[model samples]
Target chain A: MPYRFLEDVAIADVAFEAEGRTLPEVFEASALALTEVMVDLDGLSPVLSREITLTAEDLETLLFRWLAELIYLKDSACLLFCRFQIAIREGTEWELQATVWGEGIDYGKLPLKLDVKAVTYHLFVIEQIPAGWRARVVLDI
Target chain B: MEAKKIAEGIWEVPRTAKEGMLVPARIYATDKLFKEMDQGVFEQVTNVACLPGIQKYAICMPDGHWGYGFPIGGVAAMDTKTGVISPGGIGFDINCGMRLIRTNLIEAEVKPKLRDLIDRLFHAVPCGVGTKGFLKLKEDEFREIMVQGAQGIIRRGYGWPEDAERMEDAGRIPGADPAKVSPKATSRGIHQLGTLGSGNHYLEIQVVYPGNVYDADAAKAMGIDRDFQVVVMFHCGSRGFGHQVGTDYLDLFGPAMKRYGITIRDRELACAPFASPEGQDYFKAMVCAANSAFANRQMVTHRIREVFSDVFKRDARDLGLDIVYDVTHNIAKIERYQVNGEEKELLVHRKGATRSFPPGHPELAERYRATGQPVIIGGSMETGSYLLIGTAKAMEESFGSTCHGSGRTMSRTAAKKKVHGRDLLQRMEQKGIYVRAASFAGVAEEAGMAYKDISDVVEAVETLGISKKVVRLQPIGNIKG
Candidate 1:
């Protein structure tokens, strides 16, 4: 697993830390951690796909926006994803493009856990370490 | 870094406790409760005291715990002329509140049909993640509900005509401009009405035991007359709509602070001057989310009524399904308060703290003038919740506020690690609580041991004279989202 849940970070909300050797890997790891907080990934089937493209001023904001986009889609379209193919390109600004595959949420078939409300900037971190990229996020559930 | 015990159930951290602090910080808790508070509560509350235009004190209730930028039970009253409005202070769930509905039936009559009733409610009122509401509204109608709140839904035949009066602000605050809300927020929340979102959100059937009623007159005034009278209480908020509103403003306020030349210790405490354009825009938008929350609870109330009508084979009204009170614990409002012997308007931000307006206050509805506003403090499903009444002391000291709940003392991950969902289910059943949860993992995460004792939090507020204990309601059946 690329991401692990933090035991004592947020008392009422879910907090996790993710790591990867590349920006895309880290983003994918963080995305999976967030989705895992809501529902089991194994229970989801890749019958539907949605493409998202977002740009932010920095890597941290880009990660925040990416997670927020996943939450927004969950509410707006009743969609949840189990797989992510992410690409992060940093030019003048940080841009993220991803194609996430999942299916429409069926309450009867899926085991839904916590509802990830919003991604908070509290203790939010995204940076490149000497070995790889690491990101920490606290999600409002 | 030091907090001195100022009085019984009260602790104060001087302005010298932290740099850039303009006012002192006060925490309302017993010595026991205070000891359990994490270091984050002190750090965040002190950080709030340093914000520009803060007045008197930055107060944390007995249920206070570490939150994003502000403590969960944080309350800060700011000078309206110079103070700033921060989205972090109000929380992501705008107007996340509690609604308590009364019923004439007693426990004996309801015991046999409890499981059937709860199951029906579970099916009727959609819960859990990615659950859409039953009501499908056009974009315009959604906007109307944003502005009109419970009144709009009541007009649409979702509630009784008098239901609005039983709510704080009559379930609709004035000056909510739908135009201030973004399309993203609207789309995200348009289908979320009547939904009970997960994570500590629940719809429970509670009974007021004979010995639990502390103030008989107050309890009766709030419609708990019988010894074992039944009531329904649910905790939820504006859903994704409120989160989007908070998120949108947090993004804007972060940069807006730069234009205002404001610097803060924490980025999560991002704010803009209350009178500034950015602040006013957020305020109006926040009101829209607040009203949407009111409307959300209204639709949930209607669904509960429908389920009750079907299961019991009687009209909802005939079952005495009337609202006892609806109170929102999370919000920021510009209210007039006496500061320094002068009555001036202040922007009071209450995050995870209920507004405990005393009796005779002009804001309260006529029915509650004698008994004061009814304050509902929801507890963990395993523990009992409380009903308290506002007091004059709260108005004079804490800016009309009190604790919101038995705040969490343990992290969700730790809780899930300690309590297995299946075991907790069996344990709760043995304790006479029948729970239907959408996710067993969620149940483990919300185990009773993870939170502070409801009685302790209630005692602190009661001892401080902020609110008087009226009654305690025990949950008999619960539907967890």
Candidate 2:
């Protein structure tokens, strides 16, 4: 299923396992779904630009931390992202590079719907489907 | 997720249920409300059961939730002789609570002027994050407010004298040593007294509906009166002062607990032995937070009277805004309760539970002895709220406590993801009550759907005979933080 809002939680349908793919593709799909929660990719012009790179233990922790930091940016900067080109460098830890962009927050209008107070321990992966990975998150607003 | 009856109207969490548990857990809820618990909530609550110095049981009222450390609806009493006090048990926002201010006027004269009165309150009262309050105090003055609690403010004449008398612990918790508080905590508190901080905190205008009791004459004596009866209800807490205390203490206790040999199941559950210096310090600081909260609400009461006087075109004396009661949500205190029919002096930590002391309890104020401690549970700004009195069953069954409010059912993120802020505003307006908020995100995050049915939560406690309904108040207007 494509990324969409469910109840009050944000959910996504993506192909984590596309018949045999590298770890990078799966990681990229998760980021795509996460950014979808903050801003509308189709409408986001990417007029602004920046780079976020992280080195972490392995694939899963790296993705989790990336999503968390991404959320932090959404909260602190009010900027969302779209369209990612990714590559992974493996050494002691995994390395990540990506571009994140969005427009300035208009305080006059309340565009931000929820206040994600914190990412909770309730996060978990159900399983990998033929298309990709499907996950559910209940943020503390 | 559902509650299993360990006894009649008393539920128990068997010791063998979960790992890392130091003690069992207990719950008090009606069969209907018991069913609302999801599996995750049960697990989290049981996790709290495993903490050190957790004397009797990790307990919860009907309104439980998945939260940082202890479940939002959790209640635990640790033995002072060998117990621990955890910040997670008290939560980040210390003493977040509700206060009720009553008036001398009946429904007829004030109901017509309610809107104008609310507008005045909305403008006069400071709300939302970073919103400054009416009274400004310096660092030393803030320290005084910390020690005296609401009395410090009332002595300065911000609110009525009756406010301190009617509130829990007389508008201040004893043993609050302001000296234990940090400079940062004092700085944060200087400007926040009497301010309504955000997140479910609100000042609501209400009319007293029938107590739904048969004795009409008796109801009047109890302040229930009749239909269309008007009143005002607000919920708030110690602002930056309380937040800072919790933050500072959590930092203080994080390492102190290890020194005291306290092993927590989670980092957030760090605790110190009750007899230890760290424990004593946290208690003293917590009292300061509780007092600050009492003063914060008292200041709002002062503003309410001022607004009502202006709107009604009458002298302030003519418009009575009496203090019903004010109770804390996130604080730990030392109290005595019966364990196996023997009195035990224990530190009863009520994170989200209200102290529902029955009429006979000696801790109650003189005036409330006949009616018991009034339990003010404020629902969402849009739906409504409730006024209840304590039952002896609550004291004997669940550490002399009951549910606080409608616990959050869905996260703000999920709620925001589902409902548009603009649309939510329209829906609330159509309901006949007007809401003025600080930010659009504030309103969306606090939408009524974010919480469970308060009526259900109340019904659980009532059916179990822990708390009895005294009156049901529907909102007329509200000022959100």
Candidate 3:
């Protein structure tokens, strides 16, 4: 999903399906799907990079927290992730290690418009597909 | 995309003879505000106007920003007899709203311990994405939590029942049916109660700015006694539970759209007739989610009280850590109003906007009936926020709604480019505040400069007479999820 503009009236469950050659591309597509809920993302180039990390109880929690972290980075922090890497560490709980990159804040510099207020857990689930991992996250804009 | 003025601050967007349109779209904004409108706002709002049962108009407030089905500052009323309700209108966060608690703790008193207190609050209340609570529940109990809402939180002794009295509609919408909620939504919602989900959701400590009073007596009664009385403001919602509800309904409605003989203007605006079985189920489910959010906030307030009492070594009640008011910025509600000089019942939707019923309006809760409902506007940490009440013009123009926060002016990516999250944190701390965020970049993107000036946004609503200003609060300590 490269952030599409829908012409249909499909409220409630937002199905986000994307394919990329790498993990970063898939995550990038997922971010686009989230941003697409509020506005167009094609024109929204990478504006800045902000590092984010969320410690959770397990891999499941880590994946969910990862998206929520992205939303906060966008809405409250005003930074967007164009690149990302997720590393899982087995410890007391689970540590989600991530390195995110993007541009700086200058509304004037970006042509994109939309806000990902929060990451929602409505039908929000993450699992592995044959080729890659698939995650569904609902954003509260 | 040109915004042509139809009247003073009123812009008309006639239905473009689109196949799905039921009514025209209208926006209330000055030329200056129009210039600031997001490019997609026009398309999104126009799509809203095309809904099956949209009433006289699909209206957008001055603070309009791009949203799912409707713009963030959008207002629309569908006839219960003929119109439809989309979960998109209420948003996935459910009753994601703001609650302002005025305290006896003045700036001078808390300023010294602000660091310790914010850290305590941040720790006491679980925040960030996928954050669970200190309390967990079984399956059946979670269903009850959904239906009972804030009352459920109170039953657990999280807060006094009286706290519900200070909330809108006593913290529960009557029609909530927990059974209507999908099991998935239920499961996710269960552990999420009392937790603060990530993103713009946060708990902030604020100090009142000087000389901008609209109701001195009311402020005193609410316990914001000094110019810099420390007040707590936070934005959150039903979290995973709300998201599940929205997702479940969206899945339900996607296939059901074909039966309505309606051509949707946008996929996000999917809706079913309010009178139909599908629509009824969605509404019931949405109510359950709404109630869950109400309870979530109620429970958080309880946590705040506990943390404040522990940190300050005083009873929170004695300190007046009482709720001034709580309002839902994103929710669909049934309200009565005058349209074309005739009284009609409407399903008014306020997304990214708070209900601001004027003083003396019978619709307000008894506590707010005489003074009007408190409209809490949470701004960025660097900027100030406001406390306003509804006015006559609001009922007439916007279905009684006003802006919810300082609309985002910059994208997170852009903000991050300009400043490092770590550097921004240092700057914020130097300004005499404490900062707790899950991610440093998260804090950087939300730098105060990323949003519209609160003063300008609050003034737009007040100057238009939709809401009246009462108090101005400046952030002192904050947490971003």
Highest DockQ: which candidate? 1
Q: Name the candidate, 2 or 3, with the larger TM-score value.
A: 3
B1-481 per-residue lDDT for model 2 (tens digits): 3345876455777778876778777766666556655455577678788876676678877777666567778898888888888877887567888887666666577667656776788778866534567787877787777788889989998876766778888987778888898776776567767777666677888776554343344345445655766677888777766766765676567558658776766555767888889888888888888888888888888888888887877876666566777888777878888887788888888878898889878998887887788888888767788888888988777788889998877765566677876788778778777777765666777787777788888888888788888777788677876
Which runs in model 1 stand beyond 4 Å of their true positions? none
User: How much does each candidate deviate from the true structure in C-alpha RMSD?
Assistant: 0.9, 6.6, 9.8
lDDT of 1 at B116: 96
Enumerate clash totals for all models, in the order shown.
Answer: 0, 12, 34
- Candidate DockQ values, in order, are 0.84, 0.10, 0.05
CAPRI accuracy category, model 1: high
lDDT of 1 by residue, A9-118 (tens): 76888899999999999999999999999989889898989999999888888998899999999999999998999988989999999999998888779877889889
Candidate 3 lDDT, B1-481, residue by residue in tens: 5455777777887776344667778777666777787765687788888887788888887777766667778888988888889877888778989988878888889888888888888877877544567778888887787778888888988887678877877888888787787665665557667777665778999988778677897676566678767899988898777776776676567668888876676556778888899999988888888888898898789889998998889999898888988889889999988878888888988878889888898767687777777888988877778988788888888888878888776666566578887888889888876788766656776788777778878877877788888888878889887
Give the DockQ-based CAPRI class for model 2.
incorrect
Residue B313, candidate 1: Cα error in Å is 1.1
Model 3, which residues run further than 4 Å from truth?
A: A1-141, B16-20
The complex in candidate 1 yields a DockQ of: 0.84
| TM-score against truth, every candidate | 0.99, 0.79, 0.80
